[model samples]
Target: MQFKNIISGAAVLLASAPAVMALGSATVVNNCGYPIYFASVGQSQHANMQPLQGSYSEGYSQQGVGISIKLAPNNTVGGPVSQFEFTWANGKIAYDLSNIDGYPFSAGGMQVVPSTQGDSSNPTCVPVDCPAGQSVCTAAYNAPDDVRTMVCDENTSLTLTMCPGGSAKRSVEVREHIRYRVHARHFTVEQ
Candidate 1:
Protein backbone atom coordinates (compact mmCIF):
# COMPACT_ATOMS: atom_id res chain seq x y z
CA MET A 1 0.00 0.00 0.00
CA GLN A 2 2.84 2.44 0.76
CA PHE A 3 4.56 1.70 -2.55
CA LYS A 4 1.37 2.45 -4.49
CA ASN A 5 0.86 5.67 -2.53
CA ILE A 6 4.41 6.80 -3.27
CA ILE A 7 3.96 6.17 -6.99
CA SER A 8 0.68 8.13 -6.99
CA GLY A 9 2.35 11.06 -5.22
CA ALA A 10 5.16 11.13 -7.76
CA ALA A 11 2.72 11.14 -10.63
CA VAL A 12 0.79 14.02 -9.08
CA LEU A 13 3.97 16.05 -8.65
CA LEU A 14 5.04 15.40 -12.22
CA ALA A 15 1.67 16.35 -13.59
CA SER A 16 1.67 19.62 -11.61
CA ALA A 17 5.08 20.72 -12.81
CA PRO A 18 5.20 23.79 -15.03
CA ALA A 19 5.39 23.29 -18.77
CA VAL A 20 8.60 24.15 -20.60
CA MET A 21 8.51 27.73 -21.85
CA ALA A 22 9.63 28.91 -25.26
CA LEU A 23 13.09 30.41 -25.41
CA GLY A 24 12.41 33.29 -27.77
CA SER A 25 9.94 36.11 -28.35
CA ALA A 26 9.35 38.52 -31.21
CA THR A 27 7.43 41.76 -31.68
CA VAL A 28 6.27 43.00 -35.05
CA VAL A 29 5.62 46.70 -35.56
CA ASN A 30 3.98 48.36 -38.54
CA ASN A 31 5.46 51.76 -39.10
CA CYS A 32 4.08 52.16 -42.60
CA GLY A 33 1.34 54.63 -43.45
CA TYR A 34 -1.06 51.92 -44.55
CA PRO A 35 -2.25 48.65 -43.17
CA ILE A 36 -0.31 45.43 -43.72
CA TYR A 37 -1.21 41.81 -43.18
CA PHE A 38 1.08 39.32 -41.45
CA ALA A 39 1.00 35.58 -40.93
CA SER A 40 3.10 33.44 -38.66
CA VAL A 41 4.53 30.35 -40.32
CA GLY A 42 6.04 27.67 -38.16
CA GLN A 43 7.04 24.05 -38.50
CA SER A 44 3.86 22.74 -36.89
CA GLN A 45 1.24 25.49 -36.93
CA HIS A 46 0.44 28.57 -38.92
CA ALA A 47 -1.68 31.23 -37.26
CA ASN A 48 -2.25 34.92 -36.50
CA MET A 49 -3.34 36.43 -39.77
CA GLN A 50 -4.22 40.01 -38.89
CA PRO A 51 -4.02 43.48 -40.23
CA LEU A 52 -1.64 45.95 -38.63
CA GLN A 53 -2.14 49.60 -39.38
CA GLY A 54 0.36 52.37 -38.91
CA SER A 55 2.07 52.38 -35.53
CA TYR A 56 0.33 49.18 -34.43
CA SER A 57 2.18 46.12 -33.10
CA GLU A 58 1.76 42.45 -32.26
CA GLY A 59 3.94 40.07 -30.29
CA TYR A 60 4.36 36.32 -29.90
CA SER A 61 6.59 33.62 -28.42
CA GLN A 62 7.72 30.37 -29.95
CA GLN A 63 9.75 27.28 -29.23
CA GLY A 64 13.16 26.52 -30.68
CA VAL A 65 11.92 25.73 -34.16
CA GLY A 66 12.10 27.45 -37.50
CA ILE A 67 9.53 30.23 -37.91
CA SER A 68 8.83 32.91 -40.44
CA ILE A 69 6.75 36.05 -40.21
CA LYS A 70 5.44 36.79 -43.70
CA LEU A 71 4.30 40.33 -44.43
CA ALA A 72 2.57 41.98 -47.34
CA PRO A 73 0.71 45.15 -48.16
CA ASN A 74 -2.39 43.22 -49.17
CA ASN A 75 -4.32 40.44 -47.50
CA THR A 76 -3.75 37.93 -50.27
CA VAL A 77 -0.84 35.49 -50.20
CA GLY A 78 0.05 35.48 -53.91
CA GLY A 79 1.20 39.06 -54.06
CA PRO A 80 4.59 40.56 -53.33
CA VAL A 81 5.77 39.68 -49.85
CA SER A 82 8.75 39.77 -47.52
CA GLN A 83 9.77 37.62 -44.60
CA PHE A 84 11.57 37.64 -41.28
CA GLU A 85 12.85 34.16 -40.48
CA PHE A 86 14.21 32.86 -37.19
CA THR A 87 15.08 29.73 -35.27
CA TRP A 88 15.87 29.76 -31.57
CA ALA A 89 17.88 26.76 -30.48
CA ASN A 90 21.14 25.66 -28.90
CA GLY A 91 21.45 28.80 -26.76
CA LYS A 92 21.24 31.16 -29.72
CA ILE A 93 18.69 32.53 -32.14
CA ALA A 94 19.57 32.36 -35.83
CA TYR A 95 17.67 34.93 -37.86
CA ASP A 96 17.55 36.65 -41.21
CA LEU A 97 15.46 38.91 -43.41
CA SER A 98 14.48 37.22 -46.67
CA ASN A 99 13.74 39.11 -49.85
CA ILE A 100 14.06 35.86 -51.73
CA ASP A 101 10.39 35.71 -52.58
CA GLY A 102 9.66 39.36 -53.17
CA TYR A 103 9.90 42.79 -51.61
CA PRO A 104 6.59 44.58 -51.26
CA PHE A 105 7.74 47.54 -49.21
CA SER A 106 9.98 49.27 -51.69
CA ALA A 107 9.06 52.78 -50.60
CA GLY A 108 9.44 51.72 -46.99
CA GLY A 109 11.75 49.09 -45.51
CA MET A 110 12.11 46.46 -42.83
CA GLN A 111 14.47 45.95 -39.90
CA VAL A 112 15.15 43.41 -37.16
CA VAL A 113 16.77 44.79 -34.04
CA PRO A 114 17.77 42.64 -31.08
CA SER A 115 16.96 43.74 -27.52
CA THR A 116 20.52 43.11 -26.36
CA GLN A 117 23.92 42.57 -27.88
CA GLY A 118 24.54 38.96 -28.75
CA ASP A 119 27.62 36.83 -28.11
CA SER A 120 30.63 39.12 -28.38
CA SER A 121 32.52 36.58 -30.45
CA ASN A 122 29.82 36.45 -33.11
CA PRO A 123 30.03 39.48 -35.36
CA THR A 124 26.73 38.66 -37.07
CA CYS A 125 24.72 39.77 -34.03
CA VAL A 126 24.19 43.24 -35.50
CA PRO A 127 20.83 44.55 -36.63
CA VAL A 128 19.58 43.78 -40.14
CA ASP A 129 18.52 47.11 -41.61
CA CYS A 130 17.33 46.83 -45.19
CA PRO A 131 16.86 50.30 -46.51
CA ALA A 132 13.93 51.39 -48.65
CA GLY A 133 14.02 50.58 -52.39
CA GLN A 134 16.87 48.17 -51.84
CA SER A 135 15.68 45.13 -53.74
CA VAL A 136 18.90 43.21 -53.07
CA CYS A 137 19.91 44.14 -49.58
CA THR A 138 23.29 42.95 -48.43
CA ALA A 139 22.02 42.52 -44.91
CA ALA A 140 19.55 39.88 -46.08
CA TYR A 141 19.71 36.58 -47.91
CA ASN A 142 19.50 37.34 -51.57
CA ALA A 143 20.16 33.78 -52.66
CA PRO A 144 20.25 30.26 -51.36
CA ASP A 145 23.93 30.47 -50.43
CA ASP A 146 24.00 34.04 -49.25
CA VAL A 147 25.89 34.38 -46.01
CA ARG A 148 23.58 36.81 -44.22
CA THR A 149 22.40 34.84 -41.22
CA MET A 150 22.79 36.61 -37.89
CA VAL A 151 22.72 35.21 -34.40
CA CYS A 152 21.73 36.49 -30.97
CA ASP A 153 21.43 35.10 -27.48
CA GLU A 154 18.43 32.84 -27.11
CA ASN A 155 17.01 35.05 -24.37
CA THR A 156 17.33 38.23 -26.41
CA SER A 157 14.00 39.64 -27.53
CA LEU A 158 13.64 40.77 -31.14
CA THR A 159 11.68 43.65 -32.66
CA LEU A 160 10.77 43.60 -36.34
CA THR A 161 9.68 46.92 -37.79
CA MET A 162 8.11 47.51 -41.18
CA CYS A 163 8.74 50.86 -42.78
CA PRO A 164 11.14 52.06 -40.16
CA GLY A 165 12.31 55.67 -40.27
CA GLY A 166 15.73 56.88 -41.46
CA SER A 167 16.00 54.24 -44.14
CA ALA A 168 18.64 56.01 -46.10
CA LYS A 169 18.94 55.40 -49.82
CA ARG A 170 22.11 53.65 -50.81
CA SER A 171 23.24 51.95 -54.01
CA VAL A 172 24.58 48.42 -53.60
CA GLU A 173 26.01 46.40 -56.41
CA VAL A 174 24.05 43.25 -56.91
CA ARG A 175 26.48 40.38 -56.47
CA GLU A 176 26.96 39.09 -59.97
CA HIS A 177 28.27 35.80 -58.67
CA ILE A 178 25.02 34.69 -57.10
CA ARG A 179 22.56 36.60 -59.26
CA TYR A 180 21.36 33.44 -60.99
CA ARG A 181 21.08 31.37 -57.82
CA VAL A 182 17.68 30.10 -56.84
CA HIS A 183 15.70 31.59 -53.99
CA ALA A 184 16.18 29.85 -50.65
CA ARG A 185 13.35 27.89 -49.13
CA HIS A 186 11.35 29.71 -46.46
CA PHE A 187 9.35 28.43 -43.51
CA THR A 188 5.73 27.52 -44.25
CA VAL A 189 2.97 26.07 -42.16
CA GLU A 190 -0.17 24.48 -43.55
CA GLN A 191 -3.40 26.05 -42.45
Candidate 2:
Protein backbone atom coordinates (compact mmCIF):
# COMPACT_ATOMS: atom_id res chain seq x y z
CA MET A 1 0.00 0.00 0.00
CA GLN A 2 2.83 2.42 0.81
CA PHE A 3 4.51 1.68 -2.53
CA LYS A 4 1.28 2.32 -4.40
CA ASN A 5 0.85 5.65 -2.63
CA ILE A 6 4.38 6.64 -3.48
CA ILE A 7 3.90 5.82 -7.13
CA SER A 8 0.72 7.89 -7.27
CA GLY A 9 2.41 10.87 -5.67
CA ALA A 10 5.29 10.66 -8.13
CA ALA A 11 2.88 10.62 -11.02
CA VAL A 12 1.10 13.68 -9.71
CA LEU A 13 4.37 15.57 -9.32
CA LEU A 14 5.43 14.76 -12.85
CA ALA A 15 2.09 15.83 -14.23
CA SER A 16 2.27 19.17 -12.43
CA ALA A 17 5.71 20.04 -13.71
CA PRO A 18 5.74 22.79 -16.31
CA ALA A 19 5.91 21.60 -19.90
CA VAL A 20 8.47 24.28 -20.68
CA MET A 21 11.00 22.29 -18.69
CA ALA A 22 11.49 20.25 -21.85
CA LEU A 23 12.15 23.29 -23.98
CA GLY A 24 15.72 24.26 -24.79
CA SER A 25 17.06 27.76 -24.43
CA ALA A 26 16.24 30.55 -26.92
CA THR A 27 18.73 33.09 -28.18
CA VAL A 28 17.92 36.34 -29.92
CA VAL A 29 20.60 37.95 -32.06
CA ASN A 30 20.52 41.49 -33.30
CA ASN A 31 22.18 41.95 -36.64
CA CYS A 32 20.51 45.18 -37.64
CA GLY A 33 22.39 48.46 -37.69
CA TYR A 34 20.30 50.17 -35.02
CA PRO A 35 19.29 49.11 -31.54
CA ILE A 36 16.17 47.03 -31.03
CA TYR A 37 14.11 46.48 -27.88
CA PHE A 38 12.48 43.21 -26.85
CA ALA A 39 9.99 42.04 -24.25
CA SER A 40 8.50 38.69 -23.36
CA VAL A 41 4.78 38.27 -22.89
CA GLY A 42 2.56 35.36 -21.88
CA GLN A 43 2.11 32.64 -19.23
CA SER A 44 5.79 32.56 -18.48
CA GLN A 45 7.39 35.27 -16.41
CA HIS A 46 6.99 38.54 -18.29
CA ALA A 47 10.07 40.51 -19.35
CA ASN A 48 10.15 44.26 -19.65
CA MET A 49 11.49 46.15 -22.63
CA GLN A 50 15.26 45.85 -23.00
CA PRO A 51 17.59 47.11 -25.70
CA LEU A 52 19.93 45.10 -27.88
CA GLN A 53 22.50 46.76 -30.06
CA GLY A 54 24.02 45.45 -33.28
CA SER A 55 25.91 42.14 -33.07
CA TYR A 56 24.65 41.23 -29.64
CA SER A 57 22.83 38.10 -28.44
CA GLU A 58 20.35 37.63 -25.63
CA GLY A 59 19.63 34.25 -24.06
CA TYR A 60 16.60 33.27 -22.00
CA SER A 61 14.54 30.34 -20.84
CA GLN A 62 10.77 30.11 -20.74
CA GLN A 63 8.53 28.69 -18.01
CA GLY A 64 5.27 26.84 -18.46
CA VAL A 65 2.58 27.95 -20.88
CA GLY A 66 3.03 29.97 -24.09
CA ILE A 67 5.42 32.87 -24.53
CA SER A 68 5.98 35.58 -27.13
CA ILE A 69 9.16 37.59 -27.50
CA LYS A 70 8.19 40.92 -29.01
CA LEU A 71 10.69 43.16 -30.76
CA ALA A 72 10.57 46.81 -31.69
CA PRO A 73 12.95 49.39 -33.14
CA ASN A 74 12.76 51.60 -30.06
CA ASN A 75 12.65 51.09 -26.30
CA THR A 76 8.90 51.31 -25.96
CA VAL A 77 5.85 49.08 -25.83
CA GLY A 78 2.52 48.87 -27.68
CA GLY A 79 3.18 49.65 -31.30
CA PRO A 80 3.72 47.72 -34.50
CA VAL A 81 5.89 44.86 -33.19
CA SER A 82 7.23 41.60 -34.53
CA GLN A 83 7.00 38.50 -32.35
CA PHE A 84 8.60 35.09 -32.03
CA GLU A 85 6.05 32.87 -30.34
CA PHE A 86 6.46 29.37 -28.93
CA THR A 87 4.99 26.72 -26.67
CA TRP A 88 6.70 23.57 -25.47
CA ALA A 89 4.44 20.60 -24.91
CA ASN A 90 4.53 16.83 -25.34
CA GLY A 91 8.22 16.76 -26.18
CA LYS A 92 7.88 19.21 -29.06
CA ILE A 93 8.31 22.93 -29.37
CA ALA A 94 5.69 24.61 -31.51
CA TYR A 95 6.89 27.98 -32.71
CA ASP A 96 6.00 30.71 -35.18
CA LEU A 97 6.87 34.20 -36.30
CA SER A 98 3.94 36.51 -35.65
CA ASN A 99 3.25 39.72 -37.57
CA ILE A 100 -0.40 39.98 -36.69
CA ASP A 101 0.16 43.25 -34.85
CA GLY A 102 2.53 44.54 -37.52
CA TYR A 103 5.95 43.96 -38.97
CA PRO A 104 8.06 46.68 -37.46
CA PHE A 105 11.28 45.21 -38.84
CA SER A 106 10.13 44.85 -42.42
CA ALA A 107 13.13 46.76 -43.66
CA GLY A 108 15.60 44.41 -41.94
CA GLY A 109 13.82 41.05 -42.02
CA MET A 110 14.14 38.23 -39.47
CA GLN A 111 14.73 34.49 -39.23
CA VAL A 112 14.19 31.76 -36.63
CA VAL A 113 16.48 28.77 -37.04
CA PRO A 114 16.18 25.64 -34.99
CA SER A 115 19.36 23.92 -33.87
CA THR A 116 18.13 20.53 -35.04
CA GLN A 117 16.17 19.46 -38.08
CA GLY A 118 12.53 19.11 -37.21
CA ASP A 119 11.41 15.73 -35.98
CA SER A 120 10.41 13.44 -38.84
CA SER A 121 6.91 13.01 -37.41
CA ASN A 122 6.18 16.72 -37.94
CA PRO A 123 6.24 18.21 -41.43
CA THR A 124 5.68 21.83 -40.44
CA CYS A 125 9.07 22.01 -38.73
CA VAL A 126 11.09 24.51 -40.73
CA PRO A 127 12.90 27.79 -40.35
CA VAL A 128 10.86 31.01 -40.69
CA ASP A 129 12.57 33.38 -43.12
CA CYS A 130 11.01 36.78 -43.67
CA PRO A 131 12.96 38.59 -46.34
CA ALA A 132 13.93 42.23 -46.07
CA GLY A 133 11.24 44.74 -47.00
CA GLN A 134 8.58 42.08 -46.93
CA SER A 135 5.75 43.69 -45.06
CA VAL A 136 3.49 40.72 -45.56
CA CYS A 137 5.31 37.45 -45.09
CA THR A 138 3.33 34.29 -45.56
CA ALA A 139 5.86 32.35 -43.53
CA ALA A 140 4.72 34.18 -40.42
CA TYR A 141 1.32 34.47 -38.82
CA ASN A 142 -0.61 37.27 -40.48
CA ALA A 143 -3.88 36.53 -38.72
CA PRO A 144 -4.94 34.87 -35.49
CA ASP A 145 -5.81 31.60 -37.19
CA ASP A 146 -2.96 31.47 -39.68
CA VAL A 147 -1.46 28.02 -40.20
CA ARG A 148 2.17 29.01 -39.85
CA THR A 149 3.26 27.22 -36.69
CA MET A 150 6.24 24.88 -36.91
CA VAL A 151 7.35 22.11 -34.57
CA CYS A 152 10.74 20.79 -33.54
CA ASP A 153 12.22 18.33 -31.09
CA GLU A 154 11.95 19.30 -27.43
CA ASN A 155 15.71 19.65 -27.05
CA THR A 156 16.17 21.81 -30.12
CA SER A 157 17.35 25.29 -29.26
CA LEU A 158 16.43 28.29 -31.42
CA THR A 159 18.40 31.23 -32.77
CA LEU A 160 16.33 34.24 -33.81
CA THR A 161 18.27 36.72 -35.91
CA MET A 162 17.20 40.22 -36.85
CA CYS A 163 18.45 41.39 -40.24
CA PRO A 164 20.09 38.01 -40.81
CA GLY A 165 22.74 38.97 -43.37
CA GLY A 166 23.72 42.48 -42.39
CA SER A 167 22.39 45.84 -41.31
CA ALA A 168 19.33 46.93 -43.22
CA LYS A 169 18.32 50.50 -43.96
CA ARG A 170 15.62 51.73 -41.67
CA SER A 171 12.40 52.18 -43.61
CA VAL A 172 9.63 51.68 -41.09
CA GLU A 173 8.37 54.79 -39.38
CA VAL A 174 8.66 54.93 -35.59
CA ARG A 175 5.18 55.82 -34.52
CA GLU A 176 4.90 58.50 -31.81
CA HIS A 177 2.03 56.90 -29.94
CA ILE A 178 4.09 54.10 -28.42
CA ARG A 179 4.05 53.86 -24.63
CA TYR A 180 7.46 54.06 -23.03
CA ARG A 181 8.41 51.93 -20.02
CA VAL A 182 11.43 51.40 -17.79
CA HIS A 183 13.72 48.53 -18.80
CA ALA A 184 14.00 45.42 -16.65
CA ARG A 185 16.58 42.65 -16.48
CA HIS A 186 15.53 39.05 -17.13
CA PHE A 187 18.00 37.64 -19.62
CA THR A 188 21.71 37.59 -20.34
CA VAL A 189 23.07 39.54 -23.29
CA GLU A 190 26.29 38.47 -24.95
CA GLN A 191 28.46 40.33 -27.39
Candidate 3:
Protein backbone atom coordinates (compact mmCIF):
# COMPACT_ATOMS: atom_id res chain seq x y z
CA MET A 1 0.00 0.00 0.00
CA GLN A 2 2.83 2.45 0.86
CA PHE A 3 4.63 1.75 -2.42
CA LYS A 4 1.46 2.32 -4.41
CA ASN A 5 0.86 5.69 -2.76
CA ILE A 6 4.37 6.94 -3.54
CA ILE A 7 4.10 5.86 -7.16
CA SER A 8 0.75 7.58 -7.59
CA GLY A 9 2.01 10.82 -6.03
CA ALA A 10 5.08 10.94 -8.28
CA ALA A 11 2.97 10.29 -11.35
CA VAL A 12 0.60 13.09 -10.49
CA LEU A 13 3.47 15.56 -10.04
CA LEU A 14 5.13 14.62 -13.31
CA ALA A 15 1.93 14.92 -15.28
CA SER A 16 1.26 18.42 -13.96
CA ALA A 17 4.79 19.80 -14.36
CA PRO A 18 4.50 21.09 -17.94
CA ALA A 19 1.26 22.95 -17.31
CA VAL A 20 2.90 24.75 -14.42
CA MET A 21 6.04 25.85 -16.26
CA ALA A 22 4.00 27.07 -19.18
CA LEU A 23 2.06 29.71 -17.30
CA GLY A 24 1.66 33.55 -17.03
CA SER A 25 -0.51 36.32 -18.51
CA ALA A 26 -0.53 40.09 -19.17
CA THR A 27 -3.97 41.26 -20.21
CA VAL A 28 -3.66 44.76 -21.67
CA VAL A 29 -6.84 46.79 -21.54
CA ASN A 30 -7.31 49.76 -23.86
CA ASN A 31 -8.96 52.47 -21.86
CA CYS A 32 -7.38 55.28 -23.82
CA GLY A 33 -10.14 56.73 -26.00
CA TYR A 34 -8.09 55.34 -28.87
CA PRO A 35 -6.65 51.89 -29.46
CA ILE A 36 -3.42 50.76 -27.76
CA TYR A 37 -0.46 48.60 -28.81
CA PHE A 38 2.35 47.29 -26.64
CA ALA A 39 4.38 44.28 -25.49
CA SER A 40 4.92 42.34 -22.25
CA VAL A 41 8.65 41.80 -21.97
CA GLY A 42 10.61 39.55 -19.53
CA GLN A 43 14.33 40.07 -19.28
CA SER A 44 16.94 38.09 -17.37
CA GLN A 45 18.67 41.39 -16.67
CA HIS A 46 16.46 44.42 -16.05
CA ALA A 47 18.90 47.29 -16.52
CA ASN A 48 19.50 47.24 -20.27
CA MET A 49 16.11 47.92 -21.93
CA GLN A 50 16.04 51.43 -23.21
CA PRO A 51 14.98 53.48 -26.32
CA LEU A 52 12.15 50.96 -26.77
CA GLN A 53 13.20 48.76 -29.63
CA GLY A 54 10.68 45.88 -29.57
CA SER A 55 12.72 42.85 -30.45
CA TYR A 56 12.35 39.19 -29.52
CA SER A 57 16.14 38.78 -29.41
CA GLU A 58 19.13 40.35 -27.54
CA GLY A 59 18.55 38.17 -24.44
CA TYR A 60 15.45 39.85 -23.00
CA SER A 61 12.24 40.27 -25.10
CA GLN A 62 12.85 36.76 -26.39
CA GLN A 63 11.03 35.21 -23.44
CA GLY A 64 7.76 35.52 -25.44
CA VAL A 65 5.28 38.43 -25.71
CA GLY A 66 2.14 38.46 -27.82
CA ILE A 67 -1.62 38.15 -27.99
CA SER A 68 -1.27 34.41 -28.50
CA ILE A 69 1.36 31.88 -29.51
CA LYS A 70 0.22 32.39 -33.10
CA LEU A 71 0.82 36.15 -32.97
CA ALA A 72 3.69 36.19 -30.45
CA PRO A 73 6.57 35.65 -32.84
CA ASN A 74 6.17 39.22 -34.05
CA ASN A 75 5.35 40.27 -30.46
CA THR A 76 3.05 43.14 -31.39
CA VAL A 77 -0.54 43.60 -30.22
CA GLY A 78 -3.04 45.66 -32.20
CA GLY A 79 -5.40 43.17 -33.80
CA PRO A 80 -8.09 40.92 -32.30
CA VAL A 81 -6.18 39.29 -29.42
CA SER A 82 -5.79 41.07 -26.08
CA GLN A 83 -3.91 38.53 -23.97
CA PHE A 84 -0.20 37.67 -23.62
CA GLU A 85 1.95 34.88 -22.11
CA PHE A 86 5.54 34.38 -20.91
CA THR A 87 7.61 32.04 -18.72
CA TRP A 88 9.19 32.99 -15.39
CA ALA A 89 11.93 31.24 -13.44
CA ASN A 90 14.85 31.83 -11.02
CA GLY A 91 12.55 33.28 -8.34
CA LYS A 92 12.07 36.68 -10.02
CA ILE A 93 11.55 38.30 -13.44
CA ALA A 94 12.22 41.78 -14.81
CA TYR A 95 9.36 42.84 -17.00
CA ASP A 96 7.13 45.62 -18.41
CA LEU A 97 4.05 46.20 -20.57
CA SER A 98 4.68 49.45 -22.39
CA ASN A 99 3.22 51.55 -25.21
CA ILE A 100 5.70 54.39 -25.21
CA ASP A 101 6.50 54.08 -28.89
CA GLY A 102 2.92 53.77 -29.94
CA TYR A 103 1.58 56.39 -27.54
CA PRO A 104 0.53 59.58 -29.28
CA PHE A 105 2.62 62.08 -27.37
CA SER A 106 1.74 64.74 -29.92
CA ALA A 107 -1.92 64.12 -29.20
CA GLY A 108 -1.39 64.35 -25.42
CA GLY A 109 -2.35 60.74 -24.77
CA MET A 110 -1.50 58.16 -22.10
CA GLN A 111 -1.59 54.42 -21.97
CA VAL A 112 -1.38 51.72 -19.27
CA VAL A 113 -4.31 52.47 -17.03
CA PRO A 114 -3.74 50.32 -13.94
CA SER A 115 -5.82 50.07 -10.77
CA THR A 116 -4.65 50.77 -7.21
CA GLN A 117 -3.10 47.31 -7.16
CA GLY A 118 0.19 48.64 -8.52
CA ASP A 119 2.83 47.94 -5.86
CA SER A 120 6.43 49.07 -5.22
CA SER A 121 7.75 46.69 -2.59
CA ASN A 122 9.31 43.46 -3.93
CA PRO A 123 6.23 41.33 -3.37
CA THR A 124 5.41 37.75 -4.16
CA CYS A 125 2.47 36.61 -6.33
CA VAL A 126 0.92 40.06 -6.52
CA PRO A 127 -0.63 40.83 -9.91
CA VAL A 128 0.38 44.02 -11.76
CA ASP A 129 3.66 44.45 -9.84
CA CYS A 130 5.74 47.56 -10.67
CA PRO A 131 8.77 49.38 -9.30
CA ALA A 132 8.46 52.81 -7.67
CA GLY A 133 8.74 55.70 -10.14
CA GLN A 134 12.32 54.81 -10.92
CA SER A 135 14.81 57.38 -9.57
CA VAL A 136 17.59 55.38 -11.17
CA CYS A 137 17.68 58.02 -13.91
CA THR A 138 15.75 61.06 -15.07
CA ALA A 139 16.72 60.97 -18.73
CA ALA A 140 14.90 59.05 -21.42
CA TYR A 141 16.84 55.98 -20.33
CA ASN A 142 15.01 55.91 -17.02
CA ALA A 143 12.55 53.12 -16.38
CA PRO A 144 9.07 53.98 -17.59
CA ASP A 145 6.10 53.86 -15.24
CA ASP A 146 5.12 50.55 -16.84
CA VAL A 147 8.33 48.85 -15.75
CA ARG A 148 7.68 45.98 -13.30
CA THR A 149 9.25 43.29 -11.17
CA MET A 150 8.03 39.96 -9.79
CA VAL A 151 9.37 37.84 -6.92
CA CYS A 152 7.97 34.50 -5.79
CA ASP A 153 9.51 31.40 -4.19
CA GLU A 154 7.77 28.87 -6.41
CA ASN A 155 6.50 28.65 -9.97
CA THR A 156 3.67 31.17 -10.01
CA SER A 157 1.43 33.16 -12.35
CA LEU A 158 1.64 36.95 -11.85
CA THR A 159 -0.79 38.98 -13.96
CA LEU A 160 -1.53 42.67 -14.39
CA THR A 161 -4.25 44.45 -16.36
CA MET A 162 -3.88 48.11 -17.26
CA CYS A 163 -7.03 50.18 -17.20
CA PRO A 164 -5.88 53.42 -18.79
CA GLY A 165 -8.10 56.53 -18.76
CA GLY A 166 -9.50 55.26 -15.47
CA SER A 167 -8.39 56.04 -11.91
CA ALA A 168 -4.69 55.37 -12.47
CA LYS A 169 -1.68 57.53 -11.72
CA ARG A 170 -0.95 60.61 -13.82
CA SER A 171 2.68 61.19 -14.76
CA VAL A 172 4.22 64.65 -14.56
CA GLU A 173 6.12 64.12 -17.77
CA VAL A 174 2.95 64.43 -19.81
CA ARG A 175 0.14 66.74 -18.79
CA GLU A 176 -2.92 65.06 -20.17
CA HIS A 177 -6.19 63.67 -18.85
CA ILE A 178 -4.86 60.21 -19.64
CA ARG A 179 -4.26 58.17 -16.49
CA TYR A 180 -3.62 54.48 -15.74
CA ARG A 181 -3.97 52.01 -12.88
CA VAL A 182 -2.75 48.44 -12.88
CA HIS A 183 -4.66 45.75 -11.02
CA ALA A 184 -2.74 42.60 -10.20
CA ARG A 185 -3.48 39.05 -9.01
CA HIS A 186 -1.19 36.23 -7.98
CA PHE A 187 -2.25 32.59 -7.97
CA THR A 188 -0.78 29.15 -8.26
CA VAL A 189 -0.85 27.55 -11.74
CA GLU A 190 -2.55 24.20 -11.56
CA GLN A 191 -2.60 21.30 -14.00
Quick one: best TM-score, which candidate? 2
- Give the winner by lDDT: 2
Determine the backbone clash count of candidate 2.
Answer: 0
TM-score of predicted model 3? Answer: 0.31
| TM-score of every candidate | 0.67, 0.72, 0.31
C-alpha root-mean-square deviation, candidate 2: 13.6
Error of 1 at 14 (Å): 22
lDDT value, candidate 3, whole model: 0.33
User: Could you tell me which 10 consecutive residues in candidate 3 have the lowest summed lDDT?
Assistant: 66-75
Instruction: List per-candidate RMSD values in Å.
Output: 15.0, 13.6, 18.0
Enumerate clash totals for all models, in the order shown.
Answer: 0, 0, 12
Model 2, 25-122: lDDT tens per residue? 66788988888999877774566888875433333344346878888887776778889888877777888999998898888899999888746776
lDDT score for residue 69 of model 1: 82
lDDT of 1 by residue, 38-155 (tens): 8878875555666865443333355566888888777866766688888877778888988787777766778899887756766677899988776667787767798888887776
Give the TM-score comparing model 2 with the true structure, all chains together. Answer: 0.72
- The model with the greater lDDT, 1 or 3, is 1
lDDT tens digits, residue span 27-133, model 3: 33333233333443343212221222222222222333222211111224332222223344443443333333222221222222212233454443344322333
Flag the better candidate by TM-score, 2 or 3.
Answer: 2
